[model samples]
Target: MQISIIHEREVWDRFIDQSPGGTIFHKWDFLKTVEKHLGYKLLPYGFYVTDEILCAIPLFYKNIRGVKMLFSPPPQSGIPYLGFVLSRNCMNMKLSKKSQRMYEMGKVFSDEVDSLSPNYVSISLTPFITDVRPFKWNGFMIDPLYTFYFDLEQSLEDICNGFNTSKRTAVKKMDKYNMKLVESKDVKQFYNSSVDRYREQGLTFPIVSIAYLEELCQLYPCHIKVYSIMDADDNMVGGVLASEHRKVTMWIGSVKPSVKAPVNEFLFWEFIKKSKSEGYQELEMGGADVPRLCAFKSQFNPDMYVNYRIYKKDLIGSMAEWFYLNVHRKKKA
Candidate 1:
């Protein structure tokens, strides 16, 4: 087995879709797209078994003061929640007991980090496994992460029944609003409108940008879609921007606050129905922080899980560098 760095766009694109948790966003082109649109530097890591490619890691290198650190893509603008994405296949390959694969995979990644001259390495967004302690290195640590998942495999009857009676009643009341859900490829209009809504609520938009989303649309044409709820007046009231990679369809939703509307409920119901009709295995509503948002997501009866904020020595120093940039250097975020 060998590890290699890929700089070409096409090679990374082909490799990304083949990985177990592959998605277009993990492609090298996404890095270029983000660089062009949002100016973030993303490096790529490719693992190979003899001549066959096994897994890819989308990573970036950053220097904080005198210490060097490698991490997943950083938050664009003020948006938070950045994660290091790896193909689930990579995890499976790493954890396989048959060939002592997990140990080998860990060695390969850890060695690669050392070669890059980083003091420590970190991985985020990993599902909790019972035996990660066996995969540790001298300076590395694995921490459990929690994530919420809404099951789409169950019958709609089951999901609808699981909701609180009052929430279910609210969804039913949305029927009187005469809402229609439509799928669209127009990401710019949706992005702009959503940003405007966020600004009105004094919230920073958590999206990349129009150009970057356009690149993602081209990369995952069928998987990336905007589901919008239009009112009887032919205006979009509520909508969600979603990306389907592997079996997970994630939430990226916003609504017009001008009207006291049921758009959120209508949009979610439509999205759920669409997921069921399209045969998606699950719909990930994304993690929530606010109590109201958490409660709202809970209304859907998703399994509650927490995503960890793990840090290695070098990585935490990298964060300290960021703090210095803002505190001492006086850089605005």
Candidate 2:
């Protein structure tokens, strides 16, 4: 197997759709969006055997203050996961062949990344990837992170039954308010609300900028939508700007509400029903790492998933990371 910098956009996006771990964030446009926003050049590395591509890594690279660093989605970009994606051909291979291929791809990917001689590297693989042993044997450390996935294949009522009593009651209470959940193009409002929500909580919003958010929606409007709840008076009470790829993801917009109600719960329940109606069978409920968030997310009884944050760093890189986490990030807060 050989590693090459892939140049075909259409082919790559199609490959992403066919992969089990792929999401809209893995699309070429999204990669460009991240590069444009984060100022990191993307290295679209693909692993191939002869002419057939088996897997690819959408890695981002940057040299900051003499330290070469690598990231998949880039930290604080609000992307939950973005790492290597296996092609459909690889994914469809028989168990024996697939197992061998996984190890080969892992080694090849690790060797190529190591060749870059990065001072620091961070890769957060999607939950569907399932195995990190290949990278584990290649001098990388894995930190287990988590996300929740609510199954949407069940009947709407049955899915609702998974919700706890309080969540169900909140949905019912919001229903009495006669609010309607409609898909809108008002992304500006949603992004501003998200930033305000973070400020209100004395924390920095994960998103880098509004331009990044707007560009992503503009590039794939069909894959993204602002599902807003509007009150009888035509006021946008609360909403969630979700993305529809293989799964309906509650991306952003579950923020501070203008009204005294469980707006987030209402949006989540409505989003699930709307997604189910649209024939999506899964919902990526985002990260479950925060204790405060886990409380609310667990109310829906979603299945748990673990994604690994794999990394390697030299002494200088470790110092930079320490300062970033302990000093810079805290200063921003």
Candidate achieving the largest TM-score: 2
lDDT for model 1, please: 0.62
What would the per-residue lDDT of candidate 2 be over residues 1-333, giving only the tens digit for each residue?
A: 899998989878878877786888899988988998999999988888998878888999999989899999797678888888888778788988988998888888888888999999999988768778888888889999998887888887887788899877776677577778888888888788777777778777788888888888899999977778888888887767688987888887576676786777877788787778889988887759988788878998888888899999999899989989899877776
Which residue pairs of candidate 2 clash?
none
Error of 2 at 295 (Å): 1.0
Q: Give the per-residue lDDT digits (tens) of candidate 1, residues 1-333.
A: 677777777877776665554544555655666656655356676777776666566666666556676665544421123333444455565335523654565678767777778643445543322334424643466665545666888888888888888768878788688878887777777787877887776565666567767776786677677766678987977677777666545546554446777677666677778777878877666555566567676776777556544346656575675675567433221
Which candidate leads in lDDT?
2
lDDT of 2: 0.84
What are the Cα lDDT values of the candidates? 0.62, 0.84
Which 10-residue window in model 2 sums to the lowest lDDT?
A: 253-262
Measured with C-alpha atoms, the lDDT of residue 48 in candidate 1 is: 72
Stretches of model 1 off by over 4 angstroms after superposition: 7-11, 63-69, 77-99, 118-122, 126-138, 141-143, 255-258, 288-292, 304-310, 313-333
